[model samples]
Target: MSNWLLPESLADILPAEARRIEELRRGLLDLYRTYGFELVAPPLVEYIESLLSGTGADLNLRTCKLIDQVSGRTLGVRADMTPQVSRIDAHLLNREGVTRLCYCGTVLHARPAGLLSDRELLQIGAEIFGHSGVEADIEVIELALASVKRAGVQHARVDLNHPGVLRSIIDSDPALADFADRIHELLGTKDVPGLTELGTQISGVQTGSIQALIQLASLYGTTGVITKARSVLPALPALHAALDDLDVLIAALPGHEFSIDLADMGSGYGYHSGVVFSIYAHGWHDALVRGGRYDGVGRAFGRSRPATGFSLDLRKLSSGLPAAPVAKAIRAPWGTDAALVDALCKLRAAGEIVVQMLPGQLQWLDEFTVDRELVPDGGTWKVRAIA
Candidate 1:
C-alpha cells in the first residue's frame, strides 16, 4: 500500500481556523453587500480556453491542467477567480452598464519553480464590470480598503500605480519597448544601478521623468508626498493625471494610509490597462491584496466591458493577523440525568461550546476553573458559575 497525502504547498484548515475563516468570509461578504456587490461563486474548474482568456502566461503556467475523458478536452483548475468572473459577466449576466459582483473561493496555481510559496490559496474578491472611468477605479480601491479594515488588518498601506505611465513611456521610445522585460525585472528587484545603465541606452530618453518615477516607487506615507512627486516630473502629463486620480481616491479614503509606487510594480497581467494597486500590512512582506483595471478583457470574450477588482490572499492574511479567540468549554456534571442531558444537548445544538464532565471530573473542574456548570435536576438543569 502506498501512503500518499496532500501536497506540501497545500494545507487543510481545521476547526478553529476554519471557523475563523468562515467568520471573516461572512464579514467581508456583508461588507461587499453594503457596497451593492452581490455574491457569486464560480466553479473550481473550467475549460482551458475559457480560463485562459485575459490571464497572462505567468498565471496560465500556474493552472493545474487535466484532460477531461468525457468531453475529450483539456480542463484546468482555476488559477484565479477574475477570469471566471469575467466569463460570467460576458456570457451569463450579459449586462452592459455596470455589474458589481463578489466572490470567495479557492484557486489552484502550480508554480513549478516555487516562486510563489503557495499553490492552493483561498481568495476573496470583488469585481465591478461595465465601468471604465477613474471613479470606478476609486470605488474599487475604497471598497478594498473598507474590506481590509473589516477583516481587522491593522496599519495597512495601499500602494497605487498605473500601467499607462510606463506604457506611454515605452510606446514613445520604441527601443525601450524591447527592454520592457528587463526594465520590469529591474523595477521588481529595486536595482537602481541596472535601471540607470538601461536608461543610458535609450537615445534622447527623458531621464528626468524616469528618475522621478523610480524615486516615486520608494515613496510611502500621506497625501503630501504627491506634491513632492509632482515637483519631480511636472512635465509628464500622464504621470500628473495618474497623481490627480490618486488624489481623488485618497480624498475618498481619508481613513486609510496610501502611497504611490511608480516603478511599474504589478503582477505582469497584460490586460491591466490602467490604475493598478496593491495592499500591504505592517507585518507581511508581500501584498495581502492586489488588483486593478482591465478594460479589454471583456472585449476578448465578445463583450466590451470595463472592469476593476481586488482579491485578498486569505490564508496569508490569516497567518499575519492575530489569532482568533477560542470558545471556552462548559462542563456538565456526570450522570445521565435525562433533563440535564437534554439541556446540554440543546446548548450544544444552539452552538454554545460545551463539554461533558466525567464522574470524578468535578474536582478537575475546580482545578481548571471551568467557565460553567450544569447540574441535573428532576425535569430541568441548573446552570451555575464555578469561578
Candidate 2:
C-alpha cells in the first residue's frame, strides 16, 4: 500500500472542495449569528464519559477511543459535537434564560455511516438551550432550512418525526421492554414481517402492542400521517403528545415540503425527544441535515435544559453541489520594488485575489484563474485585463 493512501472511507479534500466547504462554514456561522446564536467550540477529544454524555450507545459505537497519557483515562474523539455543546450550556455558562450557541468542527466516526460516507466529517450546527417550547424547535428548523438554501441546494425537502411517538408505544407495554433495540431496528427499515415474527416469538408480548407497532411502521407519507397516527395508535397521552408536536411543526413551518415517518427513531442515538427533522435534496443520498429537541441531554451534565439543534457534514454538503468556479485572480511578477510591493498589499487588502509569479516559474493555478495582470504602467503598477 502506498504511503499516500488514506484509510478506506476517508480521503483528502482538495483545494476546490476545501474552499467551498470553508465558504459554506463561514456563511452559516454568520447566518446563525444573525439569529443571535453565539458561537461555541468544544475540544476535539475529551474523556469518554464527557464526550458521550447524554448521547446514547450508538454514538459510543461511532466514537474512536484512546487512552490519555496525561490522565490515563479513556479519551474519545468526538463523533458528534451536540453532547459537548450541551455540557457547556449546562455546566460552564449556567445561564438561566435562553442561550443560543453555534459551532463548527471536525468529528471522527469510527465507522462510515454508509458505503458512500467518509469516516471523518466536518460537522457544523447551532443549538438553543433552556427553551422547551415548540417555538425553539421552530427556530432551529427554520435555521436549518435557511442553511441549505444558502448553500445553493435546490428543492430541499424536509421530513419530520418525533421519537417520543415510537418511544411511547414501546414504553406502554412492559413486555416489550427488553426487545426495544430489536424493535427499533425493525421499525427503522419498516420491516413489518420481522416485527410480526418478533411478536409471535416473544413470550408474554401483547398482540395489540405488536399490531400497533406494525401500523406505526406504515404511518409514513405526507403531513397527513400525523392525523392518521392519532386515530390508529393507542390513546396514550405521550404518544398523542408526540403526534401533536408534529402537527404543530407542520402548521408552524409553511412553504417548505414536509414528509412524516412515525417509525424513524432518528440517528438511533436515543437523545431526540420531540419534533425531530431531516432535510434532503437532490444529489445527496442521505439527509443533508438532522436535528431535533433533546431536552434530557443536559441532565447528564448536571442540568436538564431544553435543547434543540441540528448539524450536517460540510464536506458532504459541498460534495453534493455543483463544482465551485475557479476564483478569478490578478497575477503579478515577483519583485522587491516598494511600489510593486505596495500595489500587491493594497489589492489583497481590498479582498482581491493576487498571485505573484516567481522568477522563471510557470504560471500554474488549478483553483484560480488569472484573468488580470499587474504591469508597470509608466512608473506605478496597474491592473489590466489579460488578452
Candidate 3:
C-alpha cells in the first residue's frame, strides 16, 4: 500500500493560503477584542463525555472519538468550539452572570455538510451566556453582521427565524413529523412545488402559511419583505414577535440588509430554542455563520444559562474572499558589504518576509525574477524595481 495518504475531506493549509488565513484570523481576533469579547483558547482535545455532554445527536455523530491513552478514557476532537465554551462557562468559570467569550481554532467533524464538507474546519466565534432577552440576540446578530463586513464580505444577508413557531406547528400534528423535515429542506431550497406536495401528505399543514413562507424565501428586496410576511402570517404571535425583534435589530443596523424566513428555517443543531439566524454571502448558498439561543443546552450541564452566539466557517469565508495581495521579492545589493547584511536584517526585523541567497548564489538570485530591489548606500537602503 502507498504510504502517502490523507483522510478524506481533510487537507493541509499550505504557505500562501495559510499565511492569508493567519492574517485574516488576527484581524478577526482584534475586532472581537474591540467589541469587548474576551478571548479564550480551549484545549483541542477533551473528555468525550464532557465534549458531547450537551452537543446534540447530530453533532455527537460528527465528533471524532478515540481512547485517550493517558487517562484511559474516551476523548473527542472537538467538533465545535461553542459547546466547549459552554462547558467552560458551566464548569470552569462557574460564575452565575452573563459572559462573552471569543475563540478562533480548528474544530474537527466526522462528517461534512453543505459548504463545510471537511473533516477539519477553522472556526472563529463568540458566545454570550446567561442572557435570554432579545437584546442579547440583537447583540449577537449585530456582531455577526459586523464581523462579516470586517472580513470584506459584501452583499451578505442575515436570514432570521424562530424555532418555536415550527416546534409549535410540529407539536400540533404528530404525524406531520416525517413531512416536516422535508418541508424545512424545501423551505431552505425555496422549493415551492416540493413543499406543496409535502403539504398534501400532512393534515392541517396550512398550505397558505407554507406558501407564504415559500414566498418570503423568494422575496429578495429590503425591509419590505418583512411587512409582506407580517401580512401573510398574521395569526402567529411568536412569528410576529420575532419580526418585531428583527425590526428593532434592522433599525439599529441601517447599513446592513436582512430578510425574514417565516417558515421553519430548520437549523442543524436541535439545541437552539428561540430566535435562530444564519449569515449568507453572494457566492455561498449555505450559511457562512450560524448560531441561536440554547437555554436548555446550558441546563444540561447544570448551569441553565441562556446563550446566543455564532461560529464562522473560516475556510468557506476564505474561499469566498478576494485573493491576498502577492508578496514582492526583495533583491539584495551586489557585493558582500556589511551594509547589505544590515539592510537585510532590518527588513527581516521589520516583519517583512525575506529570501536570502548563499555565497556565489547571487547570480541565481539575479536570474530569479523579483518585484523589488534593495540597494545599500553609505548608511541607508534604497528600494527599487517595485514592479
- For candidate 3, give the lDDT of residue 209: 53
> Which clashing pairs does model 1 show?
none
Model 1: runs farther than 4 Å from truth? 1-5, 112-116, 199-225, 234-236, 332-351, 355-370
Ranking of candidates on TM-score, top first: 2, 1, 3
What is the lDDT of every predicted structure here? Answer: 0.77, 0.91, 0.75
Which pairs, if any, clash in model 3? none
Clashes of 3: 0
lDDT of 2 by residue, 1-387 (tens): 899998889889888778888999999999999999999989999999888888888899999999999999999999999999999999999999999999999999999988888999999999999988999999999999999999999999998888888888889889988898888889999999999999998899888899999999999999888888889899999999878877888788889999998898656536787888899999999999999888878888889999899999999999999998899999999899999999999999999999999999797677899999999999999999999
How far out, in Å, is residue 341 in model 1? 6.1
Q: How many Å off is the CA of 257 in candidate 1?
A: 1.2
Compared with the true structure, what per-residue lDDT tens digits does model 1 show for residues 1-387?
355677767777776677788888888999899999988899998899989987777778788899998998999998889988888898889976889999999988776335546877889999999877888988898888888888887888888777765665566555666777777677776777877887887777676645743674555455676777677654567767767777777787777778776665656526687788899888777888898988867766788788899998777777777776676667776666567778888988988766776665444322133578776556678777776
**TM-score of the candidate numbered 1?**
0.85
Best by TM-score: 2
Whole-model lDDT for model 1 versus the true structure?
A: 0.77
Model 3 score (lDDT): 0.75
As for TM-score, the candidate ahead, 2 or 3, is: 2
